[model samples]
Target: MKKVSLFVKAMGLGLLASASAFAQYNPKASYEGPAKMNTWSVSIHGGPTQFFGDLREYDFYPVGNTNSDSYSERGTWFVGAAVGKQLSHLFGLQLGANLGNLAGMKRRQYFSYFRSNYQQVDLTGSVNLKSLLFGPNKMKHWKIDGYTGIGVLRFKSTAYQLGSGRVQRFTKHNAGDGTVTPAGYEADWVIPIGAAIHYEISPRFDIGLDFRINHVNTERLDATIGGDNSSVYDQVGSRGSFDNTLARKGSSSLDKYGYGSFMVTYKLGKNAIRVKKENGKYEYDTTKGTYHLRWTDPRNLIKPPVILTLEQIDSVAKANRPKDIDPRLLLDSDNDGVSDYFDRQPNTPAGSIVSGAGEAIDFDKYVSAALPGIACAEIFANVQFDTDKNIIKPQYYEMLNKVVELLNKTQCRLQLSGHADRRASDRYNIALSRRRVEAVRNYLVKAGLNDANRIVIDAFGSFKPIGDTSRNGLQKNRRVELRLVP
Candidate 1:
């Protein structure tokens, strides 16, 4: 079994190494910096046990010989935390620890049925991960990894068979005297070896659906078939029995079982990149070998791959099978690190940087609080035009005066977009719209927007409707909108 497991590991690692080589350099020119390196994740997993030969718990594990039948270990569950690094676009590595239950085997006759249980408990102190297949780059929503490691496990097991249904504090020898007593029980420690497959749902969050199997050697509990005149034999005591009854060795009594579990983990910190000043500008080599840094860059390290066992990967993946989205978005529309559902403002325009609340922080103000972004009225004017011609009407001087006030008070960039109704040809509408937007620009310039270059004008040509395509809607649609941006 160990040889087979080793062969599988060799194949998996070889494939991942080959793939990572090609996948590393495939990023497009638009991808900035060395991509994010590592991730933090957490999860839980469990499944059934398989009893081996009749060696029993005592025969295999540390439990000693006893009158009680060998009891198998029950299944187990564990929750764990991990830190991972993307070795390449499609390959990564993770190190983590887990605490959960595991199961071992047992042999016993209970309630008229010969039943055995396998159960063990453990706390994962360490684990290693290596990804063979990673989720899509644009999506970064799903990924799978194989992992394994040795960790200390705190374990125990109990062995028992059906006692009298009635409570018995002690056995009555010739119990025509109908009094009863509760039966006694015993337990012991048994080390466990376990593994699983794991998957990540997102950088900070993950889902693991896994099956872990553990082997347990137990203390032998004899199954006496010989009929004896001894009370220890119960019914068999009443009947004389034979010498053919056998002894099940501890190794033969050893058992195997599977456990499955699920868990959720949260991570804190930023996935950053590092830049150093070289010849007055930032430059550094991103080679595979490690090097000491002259300066600090939180994101400089290209993370290495996770190196783990396949069995561990499967177990972890099974534990984290997601039924629904984990409430985190792979792509944030607001450019706030937080996802949309969690972000209070879902509709913040794209490319606009935002706060946790999704509120757009003026970029210029975001850069420096002292530099207050240009005020609203500085770059806009209600430039009324002639009813039929796209010419600025002289009657709107009062409205223009306010616009002039803003431009003089605060220098800002102006954006003017014009629209027209569906009454004219698309070409004619575009021409008229251009005149309308340009008229507003020309006025803003006269009112001292400072540079004509800072003013931008665009025409929609009735292509972008503000309301319904009706007479009233047309009136609203055939208007110009102005905005100020820093």
Candidate 2:
């Protein structure tokens, strides 16, 4: 009982340690993390088994003799199959079935031999060492797991008296019990604890070596317990009534057996196994059972060339082009050497030697016209503006049209001098005056003026005010004056 208590404590501590180690595993750091829910695997294994019981030799020699030939046989075989589910990276559960034969003999007190065929069903809790200790990594191709569980064992045994060559099949109620009713075979509770190490050859398959020990609850497994008139012998009759021959002193220790085997396991289910390629490397996806192909170099992917239409190309070219030159500076309507702004006569005959007016003139006729001292009083009109406004009112249109008519009738250039009130900053006033000049220029140009270049502008920006210091006077100051220059 003390030993049993210690073993249970050891197992409990081992489980706590396993849980601690499992808690340390970080799934995000693992190359391939835990399997998804319902992931399953099936395994088959077979190997030699050994039994330790009261009927077997305690040492290499027989119980009360030095003869080694009287020792119990040591060789037997067992085959088993199991189905398991990975509940997490660190833990899982397995259900297994095993079929095997057990045999033992005693020679000193009563020569006896018992051969039994047994079947067992077990359910175990399993822990994966690889996942718990190191987490999941691609380099870890080997996995070790430990498992422990309770199960049921069913057996049918036949005992033999070696010298007489007599066989007696033991039934639970009749063979060992001195009763007329039969109790069939024996079913015993067992505890199986073991470990296995596996090498993963592929995502779907693995091979492993397993070792396990099963602790049985009953001491009657070999059909012989020591002591004449023992409780077991009294309950069930001794074989052939040879009570003295068959009975020996019994001990309190129970029987145990174990096996060392090799197993091959295959993962089951559509999502039980998979491999994927990511960032130029292969990775196993245990959840989806699929593969993903990734390119290391982006250039490996095919791409179409870009093409542009003529209209689109033109639009792009225009967006990047420089602004056009001012037309006023370059105007030479008569193909004259002098620009239109300085030319008095813009329409000059081609190849004619003209004066600065760009007109073909007789030298003597130019002196006579100039000596008469042409009475040139400036013909002008002042177009008033609203305070701080550049828009030309409808009443000012007639005055601007008269200026336009005068410009068409004579070889004269018009000067538009613009002004603003002293209400804002000097810079703003300067800009306002410029806008007033441009407004008048645009109106005169639209009113049938043959050449807009004939009109020039000067902005005073309230410096040349022709009115008094009053509100009405300030409005009058914000005006453009058209002065004709001959």
Candidate 3:
């Protein structure tokens, strides 16, 4: 049984270790970009520890080698504290100390006049360490979790009587008085295995209750009339009967001395992780400026305040070449937020909530109800861009048409935008993005769109991305987006 138990423990630890290691590789990719980074917590527990394995009960019966003598609890009750790290929402590890009593006995009524109380001082060493296992979710102020672990236990033991008298008492002392006292002894190593349930009170503190039994694999523990050490001589004052000691040999004892403990531990320190959301995307540009493409009022060109880049023309022209406006103008000559006047790159993308000058806005609400050109009221749809280009594509015609239709019908305003994947220079992409959007604005104006006041332009200059750009990232970077608002 002992061998099997040891094997089971080893296998369990192995499994937990394996899971602990593997679980981390699976990061929450879907997490909403911003999260906090660290946290800490604590626990307490108590219960009964039964002496199992090879415990010997001295029987007063003369007929058999085994005599079941009577005895009471010489010592019992355990307590401890722990500190640990939360690896995730579900797992953690802790270190603590085990302290308390581990004694028991039988009543020595007939042969002796005094009551026997076995007592022990578990001067448990710091080696007592434990692992934690939890069920369900973890890491919330009110979250409940279950845990279990193993550790090393060390202690000592002693016998105590009701009176200050040393030997067997000849009479009973008055009850309810200090006449009855407790004596404590010490003992060996113990293997403690137990379980507990805990609650996180806050990010840095948690409180819990635990119950576990410790198996002190030793004897010479029960020191009462029924125990092995009290001695058993003849009626004539000479050595007679056999030794009734319950303590075993080999690995100390074939039997085990165990105790149950309950404890409360308050943890200290800050140690939890929180993901935080930021304002910008990872792009290639540094300058701050807006871009332009077609005018939003489709019926007019608004003839862009900036020039369009090659990528920009390719985006809208696709299989064709520049018909009216020269493509070279796409290269901004003036660093003036606008592309060489009348060129497309003008206002940067809208809804990009910026600091001082640019901030990315949270647009989850306005896109569905407001006018197409409103700024930063709601999350706009993800607009796909041309390959390796921040340029708006003719491919976006359908989606853009939807926007145009919505704007025309509502006679609403709009802020145009531009974006570029990481493949081109920040300046090039930003400029291209500006021109592409200006083209859209220009087309809208020609298409009978009316509101000029409702139209605004903002260029992010290759900063935010609709998708990832690392190889498979192009699909992410290549794009433009619109946040609608009232």
Residue-wise C-alpha lDDT for candidate 3, range 1-486, written one tens digit per residue: 563475367447545643653353344431111223232435555554444321222422211121234333333455555655544433445666655544333233222211212232221111111222332212223333333344444333343332222343111222244342222332344444444544444333445555444554344343322333424321221111113222223333333444444445444433431111246421211122211100001111123366879998778687575466764344322222222344343333532321212223332223255554444323244455566444455655555665566665564556666666777788887787787567667766766666645777666656865335465456544545454444
Best by TM-score: 2
Q: Kindly list the per-residue Cα lDDT of model 2 for residues 1-486, writing each as its tens digit.
A: 633663585468457645643464443432123332335788999997777775575534323322333533556789999988654556667899999988767654546666777899988877776655665544356778878877899876666654443564353534445543232467777888889998867667789999998887666666655444233332233533423322222454666778899999887755443334579765444335522111011111224366989998999999998998665456655543345776677767642334455555543333234422232234434677888889998976765665555566556677788888888888898899999999889888889988788778899897866556787567667778666567
Best candidate per lDDT, number?
A: 2
lDDT of 3 at 338: 26
lDDT of 3 at 19: 63
Q: Give the Cα RMSD of candidate 3.
A: 23.2
Computed on alpha carbons, the lDDT of every model, listed in order, comes to: 0.42, 0.64, 0.41
C-alpha lDDT (0 to 100) for residue 87 of candidate 3: 42
Query: How should the candidates be ordered by lDDT, best one leading?
Result: 2, 1, 3
Per-model clash counts, in order, read 94, 6, 120
